[model samples]
Target: MRAGLATLVLLALAGYVFLHYQTGGARAPECVVTGTGTGEPYRLQPQQAANAATIQAVASSRGLPERAVTIALATAMQESSLRNIDYGDRDSLGLFQQRPSMGWGSEEEIMDPVYAAGQFYDHLVQIPGYTTMPLTEAAQMVQRSAFPDEYAKHEPQAAMLTAALTGRAAASLYCTSAMDPAPGDPGEIRGRLAHEFGDAVRTDHSGRDITVEVPEPELSPQGWEVAHWAVAHAAEFGVERIVHRDRVWEARRSVKGWQAAREQDTADGLLITVAP
Candidate 1:
């Protein structure tokens, strides 16, 4: 069997074991999702967290419901452990393990998380009553995986992840970043935001920071959406601090999560301070 297929088998089994028994070796810079009124925080690796956030952003951009995000996350967790892998059961690739043979997309396109997620949603919406259907049922209708039932086990974890990444869980998602920082490219940051959020979000460059704006009414949830996405992509974008409402996440600090900004909110959008 191909290495990708072998890896998929091992990861799928490991995910099942980890979720079921809560046993796994520790990983550094873990992504913790909490405050969803659940039993405990759901943990993931940083890359998994990034992928999950991207999935949530893409779904939100398309005006899809939270149910769609839940279904997508659960499917991704089951298929690839939420990592954008280049290998899978057979010609499968990316977060959702979509296959070229199955007419999902070109290999290059499928590997792109934004494109892969869009495709997933496209197929999902066609399934009538999918929002009301059980997650496993909805996912199976789209994925048609050999092990159709496995998606069920991941829903609880996925739901928690969605809550935080979607900005519905307030400041529950957190991560640590390198103390040292470098100047970031505004163009690249804008490109990444547009790629993930489509046109729903706008970015402005000022010195070393980028101000991200969503439609007005800039409620806590929407503000947190931009803030958490900044945190999730902190390493990639050289983010130093993110301020939304009265809370802030500073990379050089020990909080490793959101904390009081110690100042009042004078703006309507998220202020992402990057290294200069």
Candidate 2:
């Protein structure tokens, strides 16, 4: 009887171990990538990826972070796959497919990807806890979609896109423009960054077409925040190289350029060197 009882005890222990291994020892849902890509899987088409660039540009222009951009992209992906469609559940139209009767905007503006994205971000930022909440929850609050849970399905891909577009991660983003020539002129990139970071930016007469120098601020919480913001906007400036503390981060494009190293100067200032 003693030996039989001991065997039962060992069997129970094994079962527990198996269950723990299978479930990661908690009831938390496993992080699953649900689409085609190897990392941060999403179900958007090539055109949608281009639309995402427009969305990122709009968010960057508003001084919003990658998190906000991600939320907007996820919301749009669930709503219209980033396409500026002219139809919706009723009279809805455009990228958001917002109903004009609902006070969204005129049909022409709604179909404009940049305008649509900007309006979406505007509404999203006004939410009380949007910045800290889960992407799906924050998006639902703004969209108030009847199928609220559908937004959750796009989080993985949205995260991947944000990390790549914001330069937080390397080579995680790519897109094909609607026109082979690319939609917006590259000059708009610099203009938008300047608008967000401020007119304090300085230019060198060295004939380097697209570079700006930002004075390192005294080390403080605000300084760090601004420095981080500059780094985040690096992609918007067509910056492919950043030089600070004798280190360089270079990429073939602005999105790739964001991997540059961040160095803190002795004066409590953070120097953000970027490639134009």
Candidate 3:
């Protein structure tokens, strides 16, 4: 009787494995940000990835260092979990939970991720040596949250995101969706990219193919920075494939992450092929 029960259990477990592979393999469509070494990778939904990318983009636009990006990300993670939330403590709103009553901005401006991140950095840079300050202290100086210690918990995850979003980690960010979404609008993608990155990014689109090339990113970190941004936004933008130098990521095959490109194109900074 014991031997028969053991066989029955094995059969049940096998059935569960089959069901899971057949139905649960899609994984709910999310993006992952990884750092160097053996650190655990952090996962984020597409919307969260978009907000995090915006925070980093704003810092890059101001030519701020990576430390500024790290601080802003930690504060946002604590305040809104990197989401552009509409409700918050009292009148606080948006990614950084900036309160309009506190003169952060009008509600509409505060809701805009780019504007919110810019405001955070504007105050952050004014603090004496914020870059070198402890993560919680730097954030508290700008935020003044009731729980000044809350931001510290998010520092490690924020730094991991900073590395991927800032191009310090290459091919370290990717998204997986169930299937490709409908054909995406190149115009909308271009406009949103401009809204976040400003003049720092330039794209020339022919048909559904958009070439995102930065100026000599070899000397700058903007190459993979923009590349990873494209990957993070892939699900939202209906991006079908992305090519950066020797690496390639396809939406359908993104489960494999960034694979080696069959033909390397190191000259062009990045080639993004949206849904046709």
The TM-scores of all predictions, comma-separated, are 0.86, 0.54, 0.90
| Native-referenced Cα lDDT, model 1 | 0.82
Better of 1 and 3 by TM-score: 3
lDDT of 3 by residue, 14-39 (tens): 99888866653645777887667787
State the lDDT at 15 in candidate 2: 95
- lDDT (C-alpha) at residue 120 in model 1: 97
Each model's total of backbone clashes: 0, 1, 0
What local lDDT score does residue 176 receive in model 2, on the 0 to 100 scale? 16
Instruction: Indicate the TM-score of model 1.
Output: 0.86
lDDT tens digits, residue span 1-276, model 2: 999999999999999988965544332211111323454344344456556656776775567887898898888888987777888898888777787788888888888777788788878878998888888789888888898899888887787766655545433333211111222223654555454434434333232333445354322223333333333334344333333332333433222222434444222333433343
Q: Can you rank all candidates by lDDT, best first? A: 3, 1, 2
User: Which segments of candidate 2 are over 4 A away from where they belong?
Assistant: 1-44, 175-276
lDDT of each: 0.82, 0.57, 0.87
Model 1: worst 10 consecutive residues (lDDT sum): 20-29
- Across 124-184, the per-residue lDDT of candidate 1 in tens digits comes to 9999999998999999999998999999999988888888877888888877666665667
**Ten residues in a row with the worst lDDT in model 2?**
175-184
